[model samples]
Target: MKLKLIRQTGIHVILAAGGALMLLPVIWMIATSFKEPESIYAFPPEWLPHPFTWSNYVETLTRPGMAFLDFFRNSMTVTVLAMIGNIASSTVVAFAFARLRWRGRDALFVVLLTTMMLPQHVTMIPVFVLFKYLGWIDTYKPLVVPAFFGAPLYIFILRQFMLTLPRSLDEAARLDGAGNFTLLTRIMLPLSKPALATVAVFAFRAHWNDFMGPLIYLNSSEKFTLAIGLHMFHGQYGTEWGPMMAAATLTVLPMVILFLIAQRYFIQGMAMSGLKE
Candidate 1:
């Protein structure tokens, strides 16, 4: 029993050390954000600033051409809309894939899975050209309209979760005059809190941190999202390391808060869904 206790203690120590190592960069980012620009590169790399300051946060928001508030609003709009589309569309498609049996359903699902394996770079140009032809080049439509079509990963996650549910519930609902839409709304959605929460968390994070899509589609400064707006911290001469870090911290705060609130559902959904398939 003593030997087993020693092993567990050693494992915990190793895990704690690994976790600290992983957090070092984040710790550094926060420290840098609080440090004076001159103190940032000080020798021995202090963990805590001698005189901490909120100037970085101030400058980050008030920087010329920053428009940080507008960026926040735009990001919120895009992220919320995308999350709604992702959950709603993914749920519908996943229901069809998981519950309903059709002639070519399984084969179509295999094909859908194959599409996920196709690198985004391969389709990037073609999709861009299609959107360009649609005259959506400089619009939010290019970033958002795609969400309503459904996400492959989201669909896969939801379908996996739905499959874990007993078919008896579906059958019972059907007997009670529940059609496909009714079954989904009345029974499936009510019971899919965890999986749906997972989907929302993921969708929120994707749009929140997305840079490439916004860069590619948005041409106007007024239309820039937070990800692209952060780039403004860099000038032709040098990057504003302190204010940029402060901006990054603010940008990451919402995602952290959101994940903390939804983490229980996220973990439970993933574990339960993975157990069956």
Candidate 2:
């Protein structure tokens, strides 16, 4: 018993240390946001700001050409729309893959899975050309539309979770005159909350933090998302560390809140969807 406890304690200490190491940069960013610009690069680094100030945040928001609020709104628009599409499409496709037996279902699913192995870089140029030809350049459509087609990884996660559920529920529902759509809406969806929440969190984070997509698709400053807008902190002369950190802190806050709210479901989904072929 003592040995087991010791092993567990050691493991926990290691994990905690690793976690702290990972969080150091984030903690420093927050600290820097609070610090005055002059004190930022002080030798013998200050872990805590000597004198805290909201100036950085104020400057971040009020800075000319920054349009931080507009950038924020744009990011929220893309992230929320993309997240909704991903959840809806992924869940429906996953349900079909999990429950329905079609002639080529398994083979098609295999092909879908294979697509996951294809590097995004390989398709990026072709996708860009298609979007450009469609006159979607400088629009949010390129960033948000692909999500509605369902991401393979999200589909896989939801499908695996759905498969873990018993088919008896479907039979019982059908006996009560529940059709396919009815089964999905009433039974499968409710039971698959954990997996859905997992997908929601993933989708939100991906679209929220996506820099490359917005950079490639959006040409106008007014259409810039938070990720791309962050580059404004870098000027030809020097970097605005204080305001930049403040913006970054604000940028990260939503994802933090989201994860905190959905952590239970996220953890449950990950735990239950283990290694099922």
Candidate 3:
């Protein structure tokens, strides 16, 4: 018992150390955001600010050429629309893959899963060419429209979770005159909240922090996302470390709060998703 206790204590200590190491960069970013610009590159870096200032945040938000508010609005618009599209499309496709029977369904699912193995870079240029031909270049359509088709990984997650549910629920609901749509809306949806929340958090984070997509497609300054706005801090001559960190902190804070709020559901969904076939 004493040896077991020692082993568990050692494991906890190792994990705590690792977690602190991982958090060091984030901690430094937050600390730097509060420091005055001149003191940012001090010989001995200050772990805590001598005089904490909100000016960095102010500058970031009100920077004349940045149009930070417009960037924020564009990000929110794209993220929310894409997230909704991902959830709606993924749920329907997942339901079909999970509950509904059809010829070649299992084979098609296997093919879909294999696509997950294909790296995004392989198809990036082709997808870009297609969107360009469709005149979607320099538009949010490149970022938002693809989401409406349903992502394979999200579909897999939802389908796996749904597969864990007993089919008896479907039969019982059908007996009560529930059709496929009714089964999904009334019976499956309520029970699958955890999985849905998991997908939502995933989708939100993906679109919110999506840099490459916006950088590729959005040509106008006003159409930039927070991720792109943060990048604008780097000029040809210098980098604005203070305001950049501030913007980064603000950008990351929402995702942190979101994950904290939905962490319970996220964990539960992940745990349950692969519990069955």
Candidate 4:
């Protein structure tokens, strides 16, 4: 028991040290965001602002013409739409893959998984040209529309989770007059709430932090998401690290809060998804 206690203490200490190292950048960002602009360049940087101020946040929030609220609204719109699309489409695809029987189903699944190995850059030009031809350039459609097709990884995650459910439930429901659609909606969906929440969290973070997609598709300044909007701090002369960090902190806070709220679901979902029959 004493040996176990010592080993546990050593493990906890190592984990705590690693956690602090991981969080060091976050600590610096928060500290820098509160410091005055002139003091930001001070050598052997101040770990805490000597005279903390909200000016950085204030400037970031009230920057001329590029309203933070609008950027936030754009991000929220894209995130919500992407979440809905990914969930609705992926759930159906995953259900079919995990439960249904048909010729070539497993083979098709292998092909679908192969697509995951295809780098996004390899298809970027084609996708851009297709969207451009559709007159989707400079529009949210480019960012928002593709999500409805479902992501390969998300579909796989949901399918794996669904596979862990007992087929006995499906048989029992079938005896009670549950058709495929009814089984999916009533039985599968209800029990897969944790997995769904896991997917939502993943989708939310992806779309929320998505910079390259919006940067490539959106041309107009007014349509910028928060990720792009934060780039406004980089002027021709210099970058405003203070305001930039402030905006970044704001941008990252939601994801942290969301994970904290749903971390249990995330862990459980991941665990269940890893199981094999």
**lDDT agreement with native, every candidate:** 0.85, 0.88, 0.87, 0.86
Residue 229 in candidate 3 has what lDDT?
74
TM-score of each: 0.93, 0.92, 0.92, 0.92
Candidate order by lDDT, decreasing, is 2, 3, 4, 1
Model 4 TM-score relative to the real fold? 0.92
The candidate 3 region of ten consecutive residues with least summed lDDT is: 229-238
> Which structure is stronger by TM-score: 1 or 4?
1
lDDT of 4 by residue, 147-234 (tens): 9998877788889889999999999999998999999999999998878888988888889989889989987778888888776645
- Model 3, TM vs. native: 0.92
Give the CA lDDT, 0 to 100, for residue 269 in model 4.
57
What local lDDT score does residue 151 receive in model 1, on the 0 to 100 scale? 91
**lDDT tens digits by residue: candidate 2, 50-111:** 78899999998888888889999999999999999999999999999999888999999999
Better of 2 and 3 by lDDT: 2
lDDT of 3 by residue, 90-158 (tens): 999999999999999999999888887788988889999999999998889999999999998789889
Residue pairs in steric clash, candidate 2? Answer: none
Candidate 1: tens digits of C-alpha lDDT, residues 139-253: 8998888999999878988898888899999999999988999999989989888788888887888899998899899988788888887765554214778888898887777
After aligning candidate 2 to the native by TM-score, how far in Å is the CA of 31 from where it should be? 0.4
Give the winner by lDDT: 1 or 3: 3
